[model samples]
Target: MTTTSKLIHGYEVVIGFETHTQLATQSKIFSRAPTAFGAEPNTQACAVDLALPGTLPVMNREAVACAIKLGLALGSHIAPVSIFARKNYFYPDLPKGYQISQFEIPVVQGGEVEFFLGDEKKTVRLVRAHLEEDAGKSLHEDFIGQSGIDLNRAGTPLLEIVTEPDMRSSEEAVAYAKELHKIVTWIGICDGNMQEGSFRCDANVSVRKPGQPLGTRREIKNLNSFKFMQQAIDYEIRWQIEQIEDGHAIQQATVLFDPDTGETRAMRTKEDAADYRYFPDPDLPPLHISERWVQEERALMAELPRAMAARFVADYSLPEYDATTLTQSKAMAAYFEAVAKACSQPKLASNWIMGEVSRRLNMAEIGMEQVPVSAAQLAALIARIADGTISNNAAKQVFDALWNGESADVDAVIESKGLKQMNDTGALEKIVDEVIAANADNVAQFRAGKDKAFNALVGQIMKASKGKANPQQVNELLRARLAG
Candidate 1:
């Protein structure tokens, strides 16, 4: 129910998302078929999936458990009893004429996803998350005039998460999607892989004038990547506004995003609930859950991201932003904790991980598990800086060498590079005295209350010391000499 006052081309865009999260299970939803990817066409499907006679669908207990885990993570209501229904549709990809899904009541009901959009907090409400079986993929490649069907993905378990119309901009939609992705993956329910179709998003976009009725929405389907998701929504908003301005009414339909042209094209007319002809499945019975089971599952669940972030704030004395960023992924949080524990400098650990480490990881397009620099090596490097063995810039040089695998040992790199700070008081005093004697005019300017002159003198001292002098010591010594 979140509304925005911002407008684009004198129209406000309304957006909602429907995300399908594939459960991380070894078997299909109702059969014993393996759920591994990249198998040959029609290899993984089984009799139940093919809807052969004398075969009845059996519910996957693990899939239900995964749904429960997601509900607990999102603070949703886990229904005590839910029913399965058959959604009748005609598509070449669907082996069974009807697809089994939840209707009237779903396992998860009414949750909220909260995320930050550049310091402003936003929340998106959930309509429901229902368990359903995925249809097979229709492949059009590798054939001259005919297409092929890959039923390997048929009968795969999917949790369709429907959201209320809350997002107003493309950025907010992306943020909300990312937060949802993080939660699902964090709870060990979904893999959150967009490449393999493990996670998919469909955005319902519309535009209207301020305080006007909601416009007809066209759903952009199968947005596999966040970049494409943002692009598709932005384009759709512009297109809808343009259409309305030209006195053409918006049509409700399903659309596809063409990444090559950066435009969305209509696929087919959108179908309402009645179009599917949903009815309770005669084969499957009502799904029932007890309070004891819910409590047991909750107890076994790992600490959630928000709770972990709060703990980091209270225990490590970290800023809220630092805590939140570190807890974005479980692997990242573990790496930060290891570094902080090894060095006993929580703030320093947070800074290094958020700064240089994040930059390198993003450039390489890899996860924290693939980081070239280990926690132990980073902790040792931070220790050198903390003990004044090297300045910040010098430490960065040592870090670069270690990261590039030039040297594995921190102390060795520091020694080989000759990055040790100049801590000799007598040597520093001599250089300071020479600079003061040579720059009498600059010294007079400093005495006349010019701060820039003093900074220039400090810079000269640093330059004379071959960039090895302790900057703080130089500042203190220069200030004392000038005052005297």
Candidate 2:
């Protein structure tokens, strides 16, 4: 190992991510607490979730089924026996004082998730995915003086997915997170809501040489956003490099992401496995998953989003870029397919989606799950343009109204707002004559064989039509009239 590598946390900027994906089950992992989003604080909590005395925990069957489905999808070995353990920790948010997690034998292990960085496809190895119970949330706001602890989120079912140190850069980290996000949501296992903490990442980062002892690593926790995850890793890497260059020894620690400053600060020295005092829980028995359950889950599998993207490229005749963008999320892929099924041109549907539809969705700070424009609305707009009832420019205006709250009816908005193009033969012919008369010098230049002079007349026709004349038809009419 090179001295430099043995020396940022030494070797390379080795990265491993631990992502927590909340299961889509209606109840908590081992309790009956309602798993609804945006519930009133403490209302969803049950006696079991509150960890009261004399309460015995019971595991949810649906949670197990969901985990098995995910395990099969990742091509992992479903262990015949898995045990739950208590990870002792102290925090205001943790109502149970100890988190119920897996220690020695987890549900699934030795799996792989595949992704394409560019032209080259690659796979990131998975260490294990275990079932864990989430802690409650501490609300710093809405209380007069003291922070409130909301147990509503407590006992929530979480699948903690740990990865091997295979990623080398922040870009790879982001891409890996994105690909995993797609997979969890696509498989109907997790909701994949980063904002709601349904999906979160803890980045394990260290620096080392080509061949050297690994440097002391820090765990950066709760990287809830994609941008923040990338930025935190990059900043931590640079900080480690600078520390080594300054002849400082790297210390193992736990850190948190400061999204406001786009940096990572050390929270505490990282804990070793022995520090947690993990042990199997006597209350809960070992979970034995059989071949029958695995087979049942395999039958319930849906086509993966990545495979769907490839099919769109081959069958729908879409650009790889378009297919990739539209198929990143299940809702978007379904919406795009509906538009294409409506017989609107495939390329045209792609253009509108990647253009105005995405633009408006981003502006509104919403994802495809809450997309305002429906497939039928988009398909109808495309059809209107195809039939020459509205020009491309007018369609954009109608789409704007459709995206915003201005208008709900695409066709009515076109007629009521006078946004339709001047496609009438007689009306357009009158405008063409006026444009020729107004630009006499240009008309003379065109008659004398200067082909470019006709552009001036086309611009005039568009201006006379209030910028609503079909530019293609205007150009064709201008060429014929000028040549004659």
| Strongest candidate by TM-score | 1
C-alpha positional error of residue 186 in candidate 1 after TM-score superposition, expressed in Å: 1.8
Top model number, lDDT: 1
Query: How much is 30 displaced in model 1, in angstroms?
Result: 1.0
Scored by CA lDDT, what does every candidate get? 0.93, 0.85
Residue 449 of model 1 has an lDDT of 92
Clashes per model (N, Cα, C within 3 A) = 0, 15
- Write candidate 1's Cα lDDT for 369-439 as tens digits: 89999999999999999988899999889989988999999999999989999999999999999999989
C-alpha displacement of 461 in model 1, angstroms? 1.9
Query: In model 1, what is the error at residue 3, expressed in angstroms?
Result: 6.9
Worst 10 residues of 2 by lDDT: 1-10
Q: Model 2: per-residue lDDT, tens digit, 1-484?
A: 0011122354477888999999999999888778999989999988888888888789999988988988887878889899999999889988778999999999998788876665445578899999989999888865577688899988999999999888877877888899899899889898888999999999999887766776788899999999888999989999988888899988999999898898889888888889899999889999999898889888878877767889999888997778877877888899999988885577889888888888888888998879887888889889888888898888888888887868788889999889887778788888888898789899999889887787877878998999878788888887778777
